[model samples]
Target chain A: MRVLGIDPGLTRCGLGVVEGMVGRPLTLIDVNVVRTSAQLPVAQRLVTIEKGIDAWLDEHQPDAVAVERVFARSDVSTVMGTAQASGIALVCAARRGLPVALHTPSEVKAAVSGNGRADKAQVGAMVARILRLDAPPKPADAADALALAITHIWRGGAQARIDAALAAAGRRTS
Target chain B: MRVLGIDPGLTRCGLGVVEGMVGRPLTLIDVNVVRTSAQLPVAQRLVTIEKGIDAWLDEHQPDAVAVERVFARSDVSTVMGTAQASGIALVCAARRGLPVALHTPSEVKAAVSGNGRADKAQVGAMVARILRLDAPPKPADAADALALAITHIWRGGAQARIDAALAAAGRRTS
Candidate 1:
């Protein structure tokens, strides 16, 4: 399954696409950062983000999109922008009828590094190892985006198995 | 000038359109609330809001858009959604190249009711008095939306005057 992951932020939104299923090796399709100048009006910044996300969606056309869930408790000044950016990503995917999932930062960290409390360096190292890249993606946000995509693929596959098993059990009972 | 005011929320987004300039009787062109089911996914809910705001912009063709500025300190449980909704509203207006202004609740209250800390009922009553309406708009959100529009007109007029004066002073000094 192919997946696009978004590490949402107003200043630097990270986009990463990965193609892989649970057991197979993953391939990094692409990674990009959508940056907007703080000098621009917030409205225009949002428009820039929307357009960037739309272009990415058009090019990748992933089966599902994963966005990093935002929490208000994060950096007070930036949390709102993060939430706003995530909203744009969500609506952009939904407009095209693409399935979207939100995963928390810890969830992404745990999915790749086997530790929810892993530091950024650790998470980046794990992502590099998983994708067989010689070095971790730069700007940390890009690596986080890749980690989110990897998490969704692995978790989604496991959930699908559970769902199929439940359906089989229901059929037998009927 | 006609202004489209939006009170951004995921469940019930209030919209109001007011037309007039400073020191003139403001006319209420329209007021409505866009309600989205809580059961709906966040992405779909955002899309609903985007469509609602878009339709209002298209119909009113307002000279400017006034949106209530969202603060993270207000209602921790709902602030993220509020910010997201506001973001969608911002993008909708920016995409059309329509000037957008964000008015704080206190600013709206002060402009309409002469009190920065005015309660909802007081603000509603002041809005009704300013617009010459028999009654304030239905929901508190609706009234707040109207207040935002009124505030923008008044403040925008004052700002324009200040700019004109500054320009004249610059020319004299030059």
Candidate 2:
């Protein structure tokens, strides 16, 4: 399955697309960041982000999109902006009827590095090794985005099946 | 100037539109809430909200938009969703090149009532009195939305001038 993962942020939103299945080797399709100036107002910044994500979605057209979940308890200063960016990402993907999943930071780290509490360097190293890249992606956010895609490939299948089952059960009950 | 105020939330998003200037008596053009089922996924809920806001904008064509600023430090559990909703609201306005302003809770309260720390009932009462409504809008969120519009009418002029000056200064420096 093809997946596009996003590390959502107002300043620099990371985007990475990966193609793979659970057992097969993954291919890196694309990796980039959408940067916005802090000098701009939040509304304008969101418009920039929305356009950026829309362009990416149009180009990649991934089957599923993975976004890093924002936790208000973490990072008091940037949490609001992060959450806002995440919302845009979710809406962009969902607008096209693409399935979207939210993976926590720890989930991405553990999926790629086998450690929930792995440091940035460790997660970056694992992502690079897994994708057979010469070096880890820059700006850490880019690497995190790749890790999220890998996590979705590894976990999204099972999650999708669970969701389907739940829907079926709900239909039956109704 | 007419202003559309949004109280962003995932479940019940409050919307109010008021038309007037800083000193003149304000007229309540519309007041309502866009509600989504909690059982729905976040992305679907956002789509509902986006459509709702779009309809309002199409119908009213307000000169400016005022949204309640979401603070990460407040209400940890719902802060993420609130921030996300606020982001969508901002983008919806900015995409149309409409002037958008974010009013903090305290600022909205202070603009309508005499105190910044006034309770919900107090703020609602003040909003009713100012708008010449027989009763405050139902659902505190609805009243709060009206209050936000009232605040924008009272304060948006000064804020717009300040933003324009800052933009001009930035252009000169660049």
Candidate 3:
């Protein structure tokens, strides 16, 4: 199944799409970074991100979407912008009736690099190797998005199947 | 000017519309809460919120939208869902070419009450008195939303005019 991964941000959102299924070689379909000026009004910046995401969704039409779940990093820091961007991605996929999954940064790192605590460079290197690219995708967020997509294919795909089976069994029992 | 205030949330989003100007008594246009189940998926919840915001905007045709800006409060830690919801409110307003303003809780408190650090009860009481409501709006958030709308009317309206003047002057100078 084709999976689209989004590393969401207000200033810069990374998007990557991968075509693959279990036990199959994955192919990179597209990768892009939607960048908005910080000087723009908050509303306009969100509109830019929303339009970019919409364009990608229309063009690529992935079956599933994986997004990095927003987490409170420090004790008290503003994550409103990131959360806003993530909302856009989730809504885009969800409104289209596609299954959406949120994978944490550590989860994506662990799935791709075999270590949850892997640093950015390590994750990027692994993504490059796994995707068989001579170099990682530009603008770090892009590479991270690719890793998220790979993680979803390897991890969330199985979980989704299990969830569906459980639902089916639940219906039969009920 | 007509103003729509949104206290965004995933579970229960508060919405209030008020019509008035700086030197006039404000009139309550409408107020309601958009309720969504916690059991719903994140995307579905956002969609519900988007629809609700759209309906309000369409029905009221407000001149501006005032949203509670997401803040990381030291006393609490449940701002992520609120931030996501705030993003929906913003995008809904922006996409329709409606001017949107974000007011900090303290700003709304200061505008409605005499103190920025006023408690919820204080804000609610003030909101009821200012709007000439016989009773305080239910579920606190709704009251807070009205306070936000009032704040924007009394505060942001002037600031928006000033900003427009500055932009015009800058263009002329350039």
For every model shown, what is its TM-score relative to the native structure? 0.98, 0.91, 0.90
Candidate 1's DockQ = 0.88
lDDT of 3 by residue, A1-174 (tens): 889999999889999998897677888899999999988988889889999999999999998999999976533443678888899888888888999999999899999899999998999899888888998788889998899999999886677789999999999999
RMSD of each: 1.1, 4.7, 3.8
Pick by DockQ: which candidate is best? Answer: 1
Better candidate number, 2 or 3, judged by lDDT: 2
For every model shown, the clashing-pair count is 0, 0, 0
Sliding window of 10 residues with minimal summed lDDT for model 1 chain B:
B68-77
Sorted by lDDT (best first), the order is 1, 2, 3
Among residues 3 or more apart in sequence or in different chains, the pairs in candidate 3 whose N, CA or C atoms overlap within 3 Å are none
CA displacement after TM-score superposition, residue A114 of candidate 2 (Å): 0.5
Best candidate per TM-score, number?
Answer: 1
Residue range B1-174, candidate 2, lDDT tens digits: 999999999989999999998667999999999999989889888988998999999999999999999987788878888899998999999999999989999999988887999999999999999999998899999999999999998897667778999999999999
Whole-model lDDT values for every prediction: 0.93, 0.93, 0.89
Cα lDDT tens digits, model 3, B1-174, are 999999988888999999998778888889999999989888899999999999999899999999988876522345777878888899999999998988888899989997999999999899899899998899898998899999999996677788999999999999
- The two-chain DockQ for each candidate, comma-separated, is 0.88, 0.76, 0.67
Ranking by TM-score: 1, 2, 3
Q: Calculate the i-RMS of every candidate, to one decimal place.
A: 0.7, 0.6, 1.4
Error of 1 at A134 (Å): 1.4
Error of 2 at B12 (Å): 1.1
